[model samples]
Target: MTLVPYAGSSAPASASVAELRPRPKSYVSRIWRHGPNDGVPLFRIDAAIDPATIEDRALSAALAPFAAQLQDLSIYVLHAEEVKPLAPWAVGRLDVDEKSAHVFLHDYLAAPNGMLMLNLFQAPGAVADIVMGVAPMVVEPRRIHFAITDYDIGIRASIG
Candidate 1:
């Protein structure tokens, strides 16, 4: 699925606000089921809140024990937006319908600052860091459509 970034103001408050409520009883929810092979136990971790909202000191403190305990696993303290599918399908959809693409750009550029996806992932810290890093990086939405059409048929065909 394409990662639909929630702009800071538009994002759900709970995802961005930490002091707004009491410390949640838990962050990690582990689910276990039988695996397809060998009947081995399969596990997945479902965290309730985004880690970027937590204060740095608190995050370090919480991670300390886990860091000590989990020696084998790589402790990749990455931002929530760090790993997501590229939104090539969005460009493809725009190419197929030029009028809709123009309308989309008109609507996006009507704002003081046009929105562009950050092409790279970031490390953990204040969630505002993500916004600040992307603020100066701007691209014309129409060019995005052109790049997809001119460069790659794979991208154009991926959507429709």
Candidate 2:
């Protein structure tokens, strides 16, 4: 799954915003399961947006329409993860193809900057069982409640 920041404005007169703006790169920084019954796989994705490349002026202008919402804008990290199968009877298999499913940033102007609309899109020809198995993790979290630290011992220790 690909995660991209939503450009607040519509298409430009000369060229599309996507064509002009460089796409931000994202990676799965961490993944873990929560609770029991095979648990829900939560993936923490870290994305880097270079302020130098992204035209803040253009973004600001586009966001001017929603001035009230942007009053106290705060930076936020977004992520996507795997969910359990929807079918009650479909059991035994627990493996999920993380590549086929993704939750992408859809809109940022509807409400406060903190309020995000994440949309889940699955790749074509992907297995239904796998997709169903991994659908909820991306769609469940209303807000991520986790602490961010300068250093990550969990990942480092595991890798070592």
Candidate 3:
């Protein structure tokens, strides 16, 4: 499936912006409708993160679960100056879960300067809610910061 948004979609204040709010100071996250009028809306999360780890095997190392559940994957890298002027991504869905999508976001932030509009087309349910039920894990933190240059998300069917 493709992910994107129509015109006036980049305003960040549009009605569609609601799900993307409560965003991180340098990040944005939310969930929204993912189909035609009759389609179900899946949860979506976005973050502008560091691109350092991109091309490294480590990036894919932790993707086992995500890949098992992922229908597809796409990523974009934005330089510092292009953070704004981001166009809304036009995206479409196959069948997906929300939990997978949210967890994908959480993992995405762990990636080292990049902007990820992750569409985990699997409704895995709310992982956060379930995690809150369990004891938290302890691990060393590895923070990756992004320097966005420009951002945009518009849809286009797979060309393969």
* lDDT values for all models: 0.21, 0.24, 0.25
Q: How should the candidates be ordered by TM-score, best one leading?
A: 2, 3, 1
User: What is the TM-score of each predicted model, taking all chains together?
Assistant: 0.17, 0.23, 0.20
Report the candidate with higher TM-score, 2 versus 3: 2
| Cα misplacement distance, residue 121 of candidate 1 (Å) | 16
Alpha-carbon lDDT of model 2: 0.24
Candidate 3 has what TM-score?
0.20
Q: Number of the top candidate by TM-score?
A: 2
Candidates 1 and 3 compared: the better one by lDDT is 3
Please give, for residues 89-133, the per-residue lDDT of candidate 3 as tens digits: 312111123222222222222234223333322223312111100
Model 3 Cα displacement at 151 (Å)? 4.5
lDDT of 1 by residue, 11-130 (tens): 233333212011111112222445655232211111122324435444323323333222222111122232231232211111112122110111221223321211111213212111
Candidate 3 residues lying further than 4 Å off, grouped into runs, are 1-54, 72-99, 103-151, 156-160
- Candidate 2 residue runs with Cα over 4 Å from true position: 1-15, 18-31, 55-57, 60-160
Model 1 TM-score, all chains together:
0.17
